[model samples]
Target chain A: MEAIYIILAGSLVAVSCGLVGSYLILRKMAMVADAISHAVLPGIVIAFFISGSRDSLPMLLGAGALGIITTFLIEFFHKKGNLQTDASIGVTFTWLFALGVILISTFAGKVDLDQDCVLYGEIAYVPIDLWITDTGTIMGPRVLYISGSVLLVVIAFIFIGYKELFLTTFDPSYAAIIGINTTLWHYLLMGAVSLTTVASFESVGAILVVALLIAPPATAYLLTEDFKKMLIFTCIIGIIVSVLGYYLASYIDGSIAGAMSTVAGLIFLVVFLFSPTQGVVFRNRRSKLSMTLNEEPI
Target chain B: MEDFLYFFSFQDPNIRYVVVGSVLLAISAAIVGCFTFLKKRALIGDAVAHSVLPGVCLAFVVSGTKNPIYLIIGAFITGWLSLRFIDMIVRYSKLKEDTAIGLTLSVFFGLGILILTAIQHSGNANQSGLDQFLFGKAASLVGQDLIVFGSVSIILLLVVGLLFKELTLLAFDEQFGKAIGMPVKGLELVLTTLTVLAVVTGIQAVGVVLMAAMLITPAAAARFWTDKLTTMVFLAALFGAISGVSGAYISFVAPAMPTGPWIVLVISFIAMSSFFIAPRKGILYKQFQQRKYQKQILEENILKAFFHLGEADEQYYGHRKISDLISQRRFVMGRLKGGLQKLVRSGFLKQDREGWVLTEEGKNKGQRIVKLHRLWELYLTEYLRIAPDHVHDEAETIEHIITPEIEARLEKKLNYPSVDPHNETIPYR
Candidate 1:
């Protein structure tokens, strides 16, 4: 029952993150998500230092701010300074992250700052802390509720700003001139991303955060072109993997986050090989089959 | 800084092994890196670097001792598998290049981590330095490492020397090489082998992950200094040598500091300097050219005013009110005092309380700028088919910078047309 709650919350978080992640994928800012996920460390560290505790809302905001700054620096270098986008990102996030590591070591000491914790979260245990409510009635794990709220917010924002987001993703220059505040929207969208990752980090961990953000949405993308359908399929895939992943991880006695990520990875692989629209194997076979049929004596 | 390389000599047989080992490793890896950078395949260095981690761990698990042969073989196998996997994912899926890179990078590395933790939890003391491959573990290069590094280096260099011409052709243009019936796939395989070898060699010395920099930044920096392929290869080799030697010396001296990050620091410094200071394509040179052109534009405006002064009234001869002559440019009056003073010393113009005017030499100089400007306008409007409204400003910039060869080419291309798009007569020299 408890594991079921963790799996549900985890999948909702994946769905929420993936909904925003599709546009991010097409915009070629996948690494930007990677950067934010890493840069959020300092924010997490600083927040704990200020409130003298971890897991606070303000810290999430602070991390969100830093993530946006990372985005800005990436933009500044790639656009204004004309640095190659990938290299600029590589330098920025790593430097900031190196600094964060140094800070945690220097100030926080090695107590809670293990590298494993940074890479993989203890998702199997989320149900233990988050499920029991004040009423003593099982509210299920509350992260599922929080993730549900975030999903609604992201889905609403994506809905309201669909045309503008679509235009910016396709032709930024055209979008810029058509009176859209591309810069403002870019940062705001990045903030939503930051919050999504930081909020889910406790449940999913930092490294696998990108898996949830990228994999399910990318799988949906392979199956469909319509944005709404992509979002729907993205959520369905997210849920299926979240549920199946919990059972699989328990079966292997592995870390839940690892199992979930591997599950998402496997689903992506299946879709890439078997999806009728864009599957590599399917496409190649279809073409070969068609060619053979054409050569037949009819 | 120069003294640091001295601590790193292979002279004392005690250190001789390390020196002989480090130099060969650096040189060969760098030579291979030059091609990787040229192919714009630097990030593949990063991918291969991380991908080899599982190999290193697997080697430790299989061999039961830190034998160089087992580790190298293990690292190479996984490293090779990663390259193949990266190819498969990109060829088969919608994963973008970086996405594929980051995905493969983290998953392999994470899996490596999980395996390593399992090893550590099992209480194996020998597995201690294995994670150093993440960044690097330079201080651990003992006598055994030197032999491993030396043999690999010798083999790498032999491969590079044997296949240099083919590799160069492959990097420069793959399609042309293919169309010419060259061995594109074999050449690509050779290049990948070299890259993997360079990456694998650095695991014990520079470590694995940061070894990518030893591959990437040196070649990237070397690119800015020269256009010739041979010179680029030499420069990249030089930069890589500096990183290898300096990083080793620092690790030796500091004892606690890792060699990998230090090597990256050195490579980054060298790369940044090249980006800003290289002669041909450096940012500073580009800025200098732009500034010089701006100064020349101002001088031309003065010259144009003096040319107009040639046909003005006698009363205005000595007292040409600079105000009447000031046009859309409008800054001529403000800065022309010092410029006109130089012109006067050059015996090209005269200036006094009656205002300013032109001498014979000054009038001739002004006529030349006007001639270039109008000629450029005609070239644009007649030959290049620019709109008439756009001709003037386009010519304004072009007249100042176009080389004599360029002017000649434009002139011949336009067939020496006497009149411009604005119907102004072009002055002939």
Candidate 2:
């Protein structure tokens, strides 16, 4: 029963991250997403201090706001200060993450969070932190509910804004000509990424959230060309990573989130080596075979 | 107060070791970071930093000791591998550089965490301080650790100094370097090794996570202050050393405070301030330059309005009401009031009870502007062959910017034309 809850929670977080990660990779904002994941640490800490709780609306709101600020700062430095994109991201996220770590150390006694927990997370505790009703009824794990709702919200957001997101991702000028608010959608997409990152942070930690957010979508991208099909494959891969990672963690007696990300990496490596159309090995072989056939005909 | 004095006094061997180690680590990282920042691979430092974790854990698992040499060797191997992997992925696959970097960074970190946690569960006694690599242990720097840091710092500095010219060329233009018969590929390999070494050594002070800041923030901050490569490198080293000392001091005073984050925070503060307040390229300075130009354009446009009113009635020095200036051309009322006052103060316009009159100096100034406008309009239509209707807007903008030399050249080039494309008289001094 504990294993099921943990796997289900991992799946929900994975699927949500995979959904958002698809757009992030397509838009070439994967590193920006990585920046937000680390940068939101200060926000989470500040929110935790103010609200004095682990899981609350204020925590998500705080982290979401910081995520948007991170995006704005990166863009601002790039466009206004003339800093390169990579440096701007590096400077901004490290500063914020450092601030978060300092805040944690300052309030180490009061805050239940630790630096190690912030890095890899405590997904094994998902079954332990149950949500009990005021009427004395026991509910399922709180992370499951949080992650499930986030997945649903992500799906609805993508579904409702599919046309705008698709057009903007593929062709921004055409989207602007058709009067779609590209900037608004850009911020909105960043906001969704921030929210998903905050929700998944508890189950996967800050850095591993990046793995779930990037690896599965990247893997799916290699397997297919269609965006919708890619998203579906991402979710399927997410589920597989969660289940395999959970067992791997239990077998090794290590961090479940860590195992999940490792599995995610392994899956991507396999797909990278074997994908029929895009795999590096196969593409080279196909070119060689074509050259041979042409020579034979000559 | 006494603790501050004592910490800075460097009387204790522990404080001396921490201070020297941090400053050395920071200086080396900052110097190498300038090259990486120039190459526009700033975030690659971050990927290498995270990727070193697995190598670190594997080294500890195999060596069963906390030897600094072994740990750095392990970290270097994986850090270098992560860069290779990112390059390979981008070269072979359709994935962009960013996606490749992100995938490599997280997966390697995840693997590192798995191994690290497994080692912890295995109950190895030597694994006590191993987690310090994640956040760093600057305050706990002993004399033995200083030997390693000092040696690494010397190696990094020596290589940077010896290959400064080649590295600069590699950073600014790799293709040009290759065109010049330079071994650009070998140079790139050397720089990559230096970057990995810098991160591996610097991580002991600022930790793996904030090590990127040590490499990137100083270089980025120094870039804002200068355009010269030599000056920027020196400034980056200075900024890095300053932050390193401050980080050590901070942990010294506040025993519970971690040193790595504080170092990153101080450097970030410096970088942020540099971005805003540095001269020439700074945001604030650019805003000031823009405002000054806008004000100049505004004052010139107002003066041109008076010149137009004078041209209409053949009264070059006639007094005109403020209302009359508005009737000729629209101006923001508040800004127009300020512009008119400024014109009067500069002796361009004389204010009287009835209205405002152009002074002798103001007339020449205004006449020069009108001539430039008409000359540009004629030049555009006659030389460039633009339509008469399209020449007005072009002249309107060019009239404000045409220097006296350009004005004289335009007059000579247009053969001293007295009439513009629109048949307006071209006033000349």
Docking class of 2: high
lDDT of 2 by residue, A69-182 (tens): 898899899999999999999999999999999999999989889988899988999999999999978888998888999999999999999999999999999999999999
In model 2, the Cα lDDT at residue A297 comes to 53
lDDT of candidate 2 over B240-266, digit per residue (tens): 999999988886887777688999999
Question: What local lDDT score does residue A258 receive in model 2, on the 0 to 100 scale?
Answer: 92
Residue B348's lDDT within candidate 1 is: 72
Best by lDDT: 2
The CAPRI classification for model 1 reads as: acceptable
- Total backbone collisions, model 2: 0
Candidate 2, clashing residue pairs? none
Off by over 4 Å in 1: A1-13, A31-156, A170-184, A190-208, A239-257, B1-29, B61-66, B253-257, B309-322, B332-351, B379-390, B403-429
